[model samples]
Target: LAAGCRTERATSVCLLRVFSVCVCHPEEKKSVPSDEPFRVVFRNFQRTLARPVLLGQGEAGAARGTLQVSRHQDHPEVCVYVDASSTLPFVPPKTCAFLGPLFPPLFSPIASFLPSESHGVVLILDGIIQCTERDEFAYQEMISFLPLCCHPNPQRVLIVGGGDDGVAREVAKHPAVLEVHQVEIDERVVELSKQYLPFMACGFESPKLKLTIGDGFEYMKQHEGAFDVIITDSSDPIGPAESLFRESYFELVKRALKPNGIICSQGGSFWLDAGHVRETLDYCRKHFPRVTYGLAAVPSYPTGQIGFFIASLNPETEFREPARQFEDAEIDQLGLRYYTTDVHRAAFTLPRFAAKALNP
Candidate 1:
């Protein structure tokens, strides 16, 4: 068989031939024999091998496996092939596409065990890596504690879209936090995390938690001026999470926050997409008087880093110095692996390039 062929910003649909998968514009077609296996290659996407399967043959087809093809408006077509007979409960996709706009094509959540030294498990939603056990604390602690520490009295806290419960687990560690409210749209993510990743799912068991399986937007609307700190632990701006990045969502979040309320969201990576990070921060600034960006290092996330957009209703709120400081013993007691009083201040100190792009 011939080696794989590459395409340069080809058309939308990818054709599956017998021996070789052809990726080309709609008007351009190629003929190949039907015997050997082949691979499909796109310029900006990963290469994947395509296996032959009968289109429709009743039980025979069912036994063969399932093929899923989807595309975002700004992305190339993504094809995921799942083997029906695999022993693993959830299989990771071979490749993931670039981040797309909100409400883009949807992909099922997949959890897979890593064979690395850490023996960590990773959560992937919509073909993007959500978190990995080895470095999840970096994100969870930063997103949860950044705003909590910034607020003088974070008595009541609301978590949006943290179905895995990592954020809830971190938020519960705050001493002043009395009530914890969380709303996750998909219960399956919670269920899967509970069964596969109990370390994170244990957040659901916090005595102060009130878990609600519903839309966060509506949940916030019903509870106006309720929370002192609101953390949006959502996935990338795609699928159901698209709205969370818009100005309208910030307006709703602002309405739901009590006076002097603070919010921290999972902002996109400045290294990967500085423009997108700036755009999201700009939307947040529309409703917030004080807004700043903070960074964290997570090995599994895209670009090996992620950021948070922290904002406050009070104009005098300081993102650099934490209003609440934790001693070494207190940090240890809180089980904080990534966040500290010094780290909290350092997170806001961006590199020259990033500061110019995100702040300037």
Candidate 2:
């Protein structure tokens, strides 16, 4: 509260346009310790902010301090705000990848917690982007449709963690799907996605989708042999997502699925970390009889790519022949851009290097 003031809501930028020169350093939840000075958004308010300025930052409750300009001893008076506890931290005017930019990385948006009232995309660095309209269909459609199409008729599908992304909506596109049950650990993701990311958030609004805000593992444990297809729309394999990859979790998923159920999960990128792909596939192979790998290219995701680990309970389940094939007319009716019947067949064809490394 040095010179900048806070209103009833959080303010990442100085309200005074004249004092707009600012320093933005956001500290993601656990990646950087909260005690670091960079954890707060440092805003300097001044009519003429021409010189370099450095101000000592203590705790949030510390008394307001003055900005010590390095060049001029009699520098213009300035006010600043060090808000480490802001509900929605600001990271300057970042590139809204959805809007496209000259250099995408430089203008990339900050993925942090969005304000309760906000309705646009929020870039949560720790959790990553919450599905953008530009490329969400690539990942969600591939992950959801690849498994659903493999099954003859997926009447009951289980979604592990696709709370807001339009995963359930894509699953519902198949007319045979009677119900889609989703278990998300966090409900805020659903609420935030509904308001901000309306394009992908339609998954929550689908009548076939049944959302449960609870532990996906426990939910599966209680409902055994119930689902025809299980889709795990998880984030990176860290923290909460770490558990989903464990051998025990697969046991729960096995129990939850029908006799010939199909399962698909977000496998890590092939280019960034191939070791994770090999290891996670090993976990899937141990539990299921037939298992294979597929990938989708999404510009927003890390390495401009993401992959899927698909496994089927029945050894006879043919990955190639979809139970219900979609004609060109049907594909158009579904409004699908990335996923076509041919794409489904091609996704499983591993690259030469991948074939040698993963299959060999």
Candidate with top lDDT is 1
lDDT score at residue 44, model 2, on the 0-100 scale: 27
Give candidate 1 misplaced runs (Cα > 4 Å): 1-117
Q: Would you list the clashing residue pairs of candidate 1? A: none
Per-model TM-score versus the true fold:
0.73, 0.68
Q: What is the C-alpha lDDT of each candidate?
A: 0.69, 0.64
Per-residue CA lDDT of model 1 for 1-360, tens digit only, reads 111222344322223333233232333333222232343233333222111112111111123333332222243332323333334232333322222222212234333322222324544443344566678889899999999999999999999988889999999999999999999887766776787678899998999999999889999999999999999997777556778888999999999999999999998777656777899889988888899999888766645678899999999998898999999999999889899999999999999989998874
Which residue pairs of candidate 2 clash? 3-79, 3-80, 95-107, 110-123, 111-123, 111-124, 112-123, 112-124, 119-196
Q: What is the C-alpha RMSD of each candidate to the true structure, in Å?
A: 9.3, 13.9
Can you tell me which runs of candidate 2 are displaced by over 4 Å?
Answer: 1-122
Point out the worst 10-residue segment of candidate 1 by lDDT.
50-59
